[model samples]
Target chain A: MVNSFDVARLAGVSQSTVSRALRGDSKVSERTRTLVADAAKTLGYVPNLAGRALSSGRTNRIGLLVTDLSNEFYHRLIGPVVDRVDEHQHEVVLLADNQSTSDIPNRIISLGLDGVILATTTTDSVIPYKLREKNIPFVYFNRIAPAVPADAAVIDLTDGMQDLVNAIKRNGYKRVGAILGPKNATTGTLRANIFFELLAQNEIFVPFDYRVNGDFSIPAGLEGFQELMSREVPPDVIFCANDVVAMGAINAAHVYDIKVPEDVALVGFDDLPEAKWPIFSLSTVGFDLEKLAAVAVDLLFERIENPEADFKTVELPSYYVTRKSLP
Target chain B: MVNSFDVARLAGVSQSTVSRALRGDSKVSERTRTLVADAAKTLGYVPNLAGRALSSGRTNRIGLLVTDLSNEFYHRLIGPVVDRVDEHQHEVVLLADNQSTSDIPNRIISLGLDGVILATTTTDSVIPYKLREKNIPFVYFNRIAPAVPADAAVIDLTDGMQDLVNAIKRNGYKRVGAILGPKNATTGTLRANIFFELLAQNEIFVPFDYRVNGDFSIPAGLEGFQELMSREVPPDVIFCANDVVAMGAINAAHVYDIKVPEDVALVGFDDLPEAKWPIFSLSTVGFDLEKLAAVAVDLLFERIENPEADFKTVELPSYYVTRKSLP
Candidate 1:
């Protein structure tokens, strides 16, 4: 609870002098600045964020909004974003959305967030529209909302999917089973479409019974893999939406003593750090996710500082990471 | 920007009437409440947290201060703590002290945090001292500061360690090596001390060269295990501070083509959900981590509501989960 008054009292100066000294105002003498700082430190004084923010009308705090906080792929995105934001002396607040759709938009603004990076935007999401209508500066991470133009950092999956098709053709795999993410998600739908077209080009098509719908969760992957495994005829290879899902599916297959890339092959997306583990050498689509996250944070800052700036879309290219899980 | 005035205009009532109706005050007629609710929905009127907090002198927000958010263990802990906090309609602000400490008590208070849960408090943290001096309500989640007395939810590692030791002895493990966490951390120091005492009671003497220091990180575990393996005569069994660390060590071993259990048996602590994965089958300690996290959140809220309540230390018991890695 120590304040400027206490610092001033110890420094033999007025409270105004203490404030100026702390704020690095030119009016405060060099000798007085040292005296005030030492006193403040001794008294364990911390600057009140609200007081400073209210007076200056500036909160150097940005919110990083993500749907899933515990996901390994998502968690890896936080470090680079936070580090980059901190370099500019701004704070990053992690706002995990567990709210209903109706509550999200208002809640974001009600918190008086200076800006936000939408790390999990969907094509049909109203968040972009609401933020735009409210004139709130935001940038999308790993997702591009085509409907509402905004600065975005996205991963281009076309090249990787083409390579995956090539691999499937080389292996002579005709029956492929897939665990796709929610159909509503831009990523899931886009990947599925691209993958289908590539498969067509390779003269292969999976039956409707071979595909299972799920959200991006381990349990969903396990359930989806189980459904596919118990089919009239199991698939030659199983493709998962991401490495985490693939890990779960592989584990589930292990429960049945199914050898990876022998009994069945597996391919995933988002080459997470865990994918390289010795126990599970999962092949996946790769991109610089951390750098992509940093780009999103940078984009948000740019939009906040220069709202009139041209909206830019950064499409990071992805490639296949060949490993033991996929032939 | 639909304020009370707009709601009042739409409801055909005074601004005060609209406010009363919104709060469901009995002074307002039931007919007026319906009108006000309908107007609020139409105008998208959400209550201002600042105005409410100003009048009530409280903000329904708490801080969860963690040293490492990217760690899988803490990531898992977040889900349960957040679920509990969400049920109480409280917002969580993340505070991280990644490598060094900050003035936590003053910072939390300035941010208007009602309480805080510390997930990674070192033994001699200044945070506990400052919080005690400020009379701020706080709770420890799997961690406690020695200087401050407070409600804490922690795991008792005695049972699990004992079970693991019995398994090792029964299997004729003559020599043991341990990768302990930082010397300053209470959990690390406590586990190491208890483990050594039990080993000695079992008439097993651990060689000085078998011990390695770490910071509870994968890299630390990897390097520490390498350091141990470099010894002329390595131990027969290796015990890591936690599952993540054990995984790192196991991976390091895998790189050298060292077969686990046959080459060197491994054990771990805090058997994470992934330990039971067929790929890992990591023998380690087991406790209800979700329940432990929920208990910590509950303790924080209890401290906030009843500041004068008796300080209690709740220790959750752990047991051994025998898996392939240890056998």
Candidate 2:
């Protein structure tokens, strides 16, 4: 419990001088800085972040707001983001939007974060507007809210979808079923629109009853697949919103004793690590997930450092990764 | 960015009065508190946590120190911990020990956290000693460092191990290969000792060459399985350290075209959500993960509130879950 005052007493300097010296403020002389540092290290005095933040208006803490921590996708995303943030000497404060409370913006504000990386914002979320009103710097990750302009790192699924459509056409799949994510999410809506448009252009039409939208969850995929299969005529090919959903669909297929690719082709987006597992071997739209995380952290830091800078959106390209799931 | 001064000016009170009223100090008049609250709401002022922390040495922040963020085990653990911490009106600060800097203890101290929950401490780690020297309160989650005694929530593998050993005896498996976790971790060492002791009691002896120790990871499992299978006489059954490693072994078996439970039986610990997946259907030891998280968080909060209380360790019991992985 050694405090700055203790270090100051041991170093024979004023408490303010000790603070400045320990902070490496150039105002303090080199000799004073060394003396203070030695004294602090001897006493094992760890400077409190709150006091430092009060003096410098920076907490060196960034908020990573994710919606679902249980999702496998976030499992990979959180690690890279934490590593990158650590490189900048900032800690990550995990914030989950799982609670039904609408005071998430206020919670973020109360934490006194330097900035936030919004990994779970929906297209219609009011959090962005509230944050804008409070002048809190934030950057969108994977999803964006049009109500407020901000920096974002998102994926362009056009090329990948095109390649997937080509595969569908070549495979001569007559009926196609889709299990999309929630409509409120930009990732879901945009991916669905692009997929449907591409499929139409390729003369592969999905009937209205063949499409289902749910949250990006395994249960949703499982139920969606069951519902689609019970239809009068099931689609030979099923497109899942993401790898998690695809895995769920595969699990459902296993329960029903349906063989993958041989009986029904399954394709997914976001080729997460599990997609490549020998058992899953899921065909998915792939992108550099680590790169996406790095870009998002970069954008958030940029927004924090240059608050008045022009809002920029960095869209990373995606590609199709063919595996055993697709015929 | 409305400061306390703005609220004080609008409320016709001193800045200190405004602060006291907002913090619900008993000395402040109810009428004055209402006036300050109204003014604060009107100005949209969010109290700076730094200022609050400086005044009342509590950050209301709890740190959850984890070794591997990419591990699916943590993915499930983090959500429940976050949820439990949130119920106490506190935020969770995620601290990963992935860096080789050896300054993790210092980093925790610098964050000014009220307490920490250690989820990944090796038995020989110096972190517990450092935290104890600093008088920082922490509770062990899943793993513990025996050097410094503290509150902990651990698992007891006796019942589960006994059941599993009974299953092994019933199946009449003569040769056994094992993929254990790191020798440095208490979990790995404890589980291995218990399993081996139980097997010895039942007159089942594993040859020295059939055991491979590794970190609790998929890659480790895969590599360990490969190494074991290459032996002149490969064992018929493989015991994985945990579910994640079990998955890697399963993947390796699939790649080598080895039929699980037919060519080789696999048994894993920590029956993770993926264990019951139709693709995996792994037989493993099961515990209430959510309850463990809650107990850890509760122990942390208890220690934070009463630092002088005698350290208590709550050991949750585990059970064996049967599936296709084990014959």
Candidate 3:
């Protein structure tokens, strides 16, 4: 029940000054802000989110819209996004886009999220348009919708793919296979484009049978790898869409008793924590996923606070991590 | 601007009936509820959570208070918990217990959460007390606080540990090393008690130097295993506090070039999804974590709707999973 009045009384400041201080308005001096904050802490005063939202038009709650909650790849982003949101004095509302449930736009409005970070927007997704119609600010993380442009943080896989192709060439693996992600997704298409272009430039061609499409999942990798291996002339190497798929491929290799880097080499993108485990040591295209997630949060907050800010697309650097999987 | 009145007009029902139908009151007949829901959907009406909270005293948001956000072990639980919550027309607000930030109880109140599910309560944690003081309904998940009794969903590790120890005896392995979890944790203490008691019954004892305490983290497992291995006569087998720690021990074993099941067998608890990866196949105790998380949410909702109901403790079944690590 503690309110700004109690904090102001305890801090010996005017009620308006206490409100401004608590709201992080620059008009309030640091000394007064600290004084009010300390008093608020002592009084155990927590500004009601609903009241604050009504008064300041900000809920301090950001939604992270993920399409696939079961995917472990999304799991890695939650911690980093939450950490950065917490740094900005905000909390995360994990919004899973389940088709069976109510639409995401309704959930966002119902929950009163200040902004949203779309981590799994397909190129043709209508979510961005819905968000724009509602005047809800959103930042795309690792994916983009050209139809409805917004702030985005995406990976530049050009350099990493080149390094991986070079490594493949050096190892003299001619028959190559690939488990590509869905062509509808920007992340999947971009990586596939870079991967195939690099390999084609090196006179390496993956047969149609060897080129399988997955949903960037573990089962996709397992099934794709198994399908490739079942062929009369199996591929000597498999390039997966991402680490989760690559892990599946590795597991499949184990099931078939195929030695990594000996029977068939595997390379993955994203280089999730599991790829780095000593047992796997999966060589993968690497980027700071934590940093990418954090930046997406930062961009979303910036857009929320400054709606007039120019739309930005931050392309982070990537490199190939040479590990036992390839060597 | 579309409100219950608009839905009521479209559905040819009274405004209060629309409200009751939207709030899922059983008093509203199924056909009327269906008509109201369809009308609301057609109008794209999102009931304002703040207004609804003041009127109905329900926020439809649940806080999942976790101590460690960076751990992958917690990541597996989030998806299932969110799915279950969404099934009941609720959303999850991920709340991390960071001391540098505002206290959890204050955050809970500020966020206007209907209930909370405490997933990481150490035995000495003050969170339970704070929640009780505020009369906030909560359910303990896989952990408990003796000072404050509440509804809980936890695994019964007694039978599983017995099976594990019996397998250990049958294998004729001795000079066992253990990485026990923090003694202050209910989960850690309970598991350790079962482990040691079973070993004692089998006339096997772990030397003081062989038994180490960890905080149930990856680094803790790595350090504990390394410490045990550094002894002049290292134990033939190592039991970790949990799956995360067990993975650490397995990684440490790989680092020392010790062949699993040949040089030192490894055992873990929890049997996380990663433990079943073909690359790992980690021997561990198994329980239905998804069910456990879902039941915690269920218990919290039960307490929220029927606060006078006697608190119930749901003990889930557990068993031992023997995989390549033990073989």
**What TM-score do all the candidates reach, one by one?**
0.84, 0.90, 0.96
For candidate 2, give the DockQ: 0.62
- lDDT for residue B71 in candidate 3, whole number 0-100: 76
The candidate, 1 or 2, that scores higher on TM-score is 2
Assess the local accuracy of residue B213 in candidate 2 as a C-alpha lDDT between 0 and 100.
Answer: 88
TM-score of 2: 0.90
Badly placed stretches (over 4 Å) of model 3 are B98-102
Error of 3 at B318 (Å): 1.4
RMSD of each: 4.7, 3.8, 2.0
Q: DockQ for model 3?
A: 0.60
TM-scores of chain B, in order: 0.86, 0.87, 0.97
Q: Candidate 2 has which clashing residue pairs, if any?
A: none
CA lDDT, every model vs. true structure: 0.79, 0.88, 0.86
Where does candidate 2 chain B have its weakest 10-residue lDDT segment?
Answer: B94-103
- Expressed as tens digits, the lDDT of each residue in B171-255 for candidate 1 is 9999899998988888888888888988999999788889998988777768888888888988889989888888888878877
Candidate 1 Cα errors over 4 Å, as ranges: A1-45, A56-60, A88-93, A98-102, A121-124, A162-176, A204-207, A229-234, A308-310, B4-43, B53-59, B99-112, B133-136, B170-172, B225-234, B306-310
